[model samples]
Target: MGEENLAAVLHAAEDLRLEKWPLPEPKENEVLVRMARVGICGSDVHFLKHGRIGDFVVKKPMVIGHESSGVVVRCGKAVTSLKPGDKVALEPGVPCRHCSYCKEGIYNVCPKVSFFACPPTSGTMARYFCHPEDFCFKLPDNVSLEEGALLEPLAVGVHSCRRGGVGLGSKVLVIGAGPIGLVTLLTAKAMGAATVILTDVVEQRLEVAKKIGADGTLLTGKLNEEEIVKQIWNLFGGDGPDVALDCSGTEPGQRLAFLAPKPRGVAVMVGVGPPEIKAPLLSACLREVDIKTIFRYCNDYPAALAMLASGKVNVKQLITHNYKLEEALQAFQTARSGVGNPIKIMVHCSQ
Candidate 1:
């Protein structure tokens, strides 16, 4: 490999450029990886278009990818878990080990966590980047690099289902048929949920969801909130689902998360929506629905990997587009434009 490390750099809103980034060196606890597959996330498109996601604003140039898989190129002296030539999926966030939250094993909320592609921190979109050894999960022989790249989003699904207490025979409702929602549906089914219903405004996405394993799908574009809720309730035989996972993060989706769950059931917010919204909080409170939220993920990577390796969850069909590292701008444009209704756009970072 050469020292010329090319990357898709985001300068500001609508300002993405291909440039040669500095080749990073691994610290004792880190390993250098030659990136193979990088998936473009919705957050990547959001940051490129708006230069911000809530309070985290892109004030300077930064590499712009997070969902990625790579081959280990070099390992630092003290890195014992991984070795050169190993294929691994990169978990973007690395939290401070000393944080109280990290001590409690919920490092996703560590205040000083440095997550890839989140404003100031550089991401794994480049040809080569360094990541902490502990944060990278080695891929099994059965998992392709593409599937490994997808594990990042799959981890979110695993975490969301776990938070929602999806288990054997648990009925689950997922709001939105986006990437996250689809993965959540897959996870819930793999976790032995008896019924998993997904809702989305896009019929195409719902079609995809049905193909993947959603027991039922509702197209909610033409329906009002109340009607949609009633229809969702009907799906579970005149009763709300055991758990409602909101992956749309829209006001309607969040409200449904609260309203469409059985009494004393769980509602987990998996999407990043607007900072504030008018929700049916009192109604949910009165019904005793337990509201919860997931930041990124905590200790869920192994489950995601196991599911993929065991053929329990298939994410291959969700990848609708592919581009080379040089065509990253076009990839981002295609993703943003929704040309062909692409579910996942994968970028090959290695030449």
Candidate 2:
């Protein structure tokens, strides 16, 4: 292991630098990890550009990254599940286990969670950091470190599928063909959805979604709400889909999620958008379309890894670019520019 800990730190909006952060040590129940791959998320870009995500604001310098995988360098005395030299996928958010939400097995909403790369919480875009042993899942022999890094987003898809009740012979509609939407499409198909239609404003993204396994693709670039709804119904045998997932999180996406589902179907908000958006609540209520929202993920990492090991989901296809820790700014630039339709950009943290 190297003596110097290099990290991608954000000083303020649009001010990112590679600084030497103090290497973290493992605590009684944590393990020290040498980070290998850290995937850049949309939130990371948003924070870099604006320095705030809703209420979470970056008031001081903080390390930035969350979707990461690494090898265990040292284990705390109480970390029985993992040992040195173990390769693992890190679950970023660690919640207070005593909270009511955590006790109910829905810890993703625990108000006391210390999620990586969010405002005040320092993230894992460094050579070494410490995490609770329970939050790190050992990677199967077949799963590469790159794939392990992707498990974080894949877990979101798994959680969305479960929330939307996606199952055998189901028909699903996913809005926005971005990384989250693509993963949702793959997860729905892997869960045995009979048909999965993906809608996106970007033609290139829709094309990628089709190639990956979307049963149908719709380019709703200029289409209005009614037109999109009509097109979606036509794509699903002249009827709405059994489940609709709004991965875009735009007002239009939220409205369409309620409008594009069959009566008594499910509508899930997988992406975080504005604090408030005008949605068709009355219409959804009349049709009995249940609505649900996802906050990160809970108890879904194992399922995501299992899907990867079983060859049921291939997340590597979503990765469009890669960079080293030193070239982090360039990577973020490519991601922010949307050049070449970058889907997922990965930053290698370990030498």
Candidate 3:
């Protein structure tokens, strides 16, 4: 209702400030949403702490948040799917429809895509934000705004599972136990994975994974590469898993997952880590193991929403802390510390 809305802007590395910004208006195909909850992502922390993630650099001040949900306050004349007072989850990435990637239905790989909180595109860490009407999926009455905000990350999990070819009775090993890892575990289980083994160096995170229905949790800190492989074999009852999803991008995690799967098994890399690592390619090549890597996600929002609405995936448990927009810096600090079981930290824009 006012010209200015509160926004958390990252002016420089590790220097985030809450400021007043003019509320954005909806375009012909867009809708204006009053942001309710914005989840702090690992990428957000990476950009804040290091100022850059690979090629994308924070050259200018940008609002920092992508996983978000909000209430539609205004709709453009041409917007038909959503209306004022509708609660929805914003997909955050707007791909160019003219590109071949978009035409092929894999718009997440569109080179010209504009994603929120990414280098040049401002994010939804503000009270009032405008997004394309088609990108905002209306939330069901049963889903809360908090659950809606988590749909962004859950979409990634769904996408990763789909890419990994997970299905009924599939045996899955998820490496990482972080937010994405836990979500992937949940997705696999919901997809009918008979056994889901989660591995993480953090005991607390592994404990959380066990609480979330991981058939087994492995502490990777005490095991070396070969021992880790042995443990996974044991978890699979002497037979390696059918699918191994590496949600932890660390070299060790990748190595373990690569060696822990059965011959001709599928190995999916879902986490962001170093560009290159000394992997055991010979072993993988000898076994005909299929190695696949997932980009952000493609066309997964609807499935994520459906899963949440059906109660197949309970993401609310992932949230461990909440902060007002003004306390974004502190929130980032807490996330970076990783002291307490901080699975997800949310920032309330209206607070």
Assess the local accuracy of residue 66 in candidate 2 as a C-alpha lDDT between 0 and 100: 98
How high a TM-score does candidate 1 get? 0.98
Candidate 1 on 1-351: residue-level lDDT in tens? Answer: 756999999999999999999999999999999999999999999999999998899999999999999999999999999999999999999999897999999999999999999979988889999999999999988999999999999999999999988999999999999999999999999999999999999999999999998899999999998999899999999999999999997988999999999899999999998889899999899889999999889999999999999999998879999999999999999999999899999999984
Write down the worst ten-residue block by lDDT for model 3: 2-11
**Best first by lDDT, ranked:** 1, 2, 3
TM-score of 2: 0.99
Worst 10 residues of 2 by lDDT: 1-10
Q: List model 3 lDDT by residue over 103-127, tens digit each.
A: 9999999999999999998899998
Q: For model 2, name the residue pairs that clash.
A: none
lDDT to native, each model: 0.94, 0.94, 0.91
Residue 100's lDDT within candidate 1 is 92
Q: Write the per-residue lDDT of candidate 2 for residues 217-321, one digit (tens) a residue.
A: 999989888999999999999999999999997988888899999899999999898888888999899999999999888999999999999999999999999
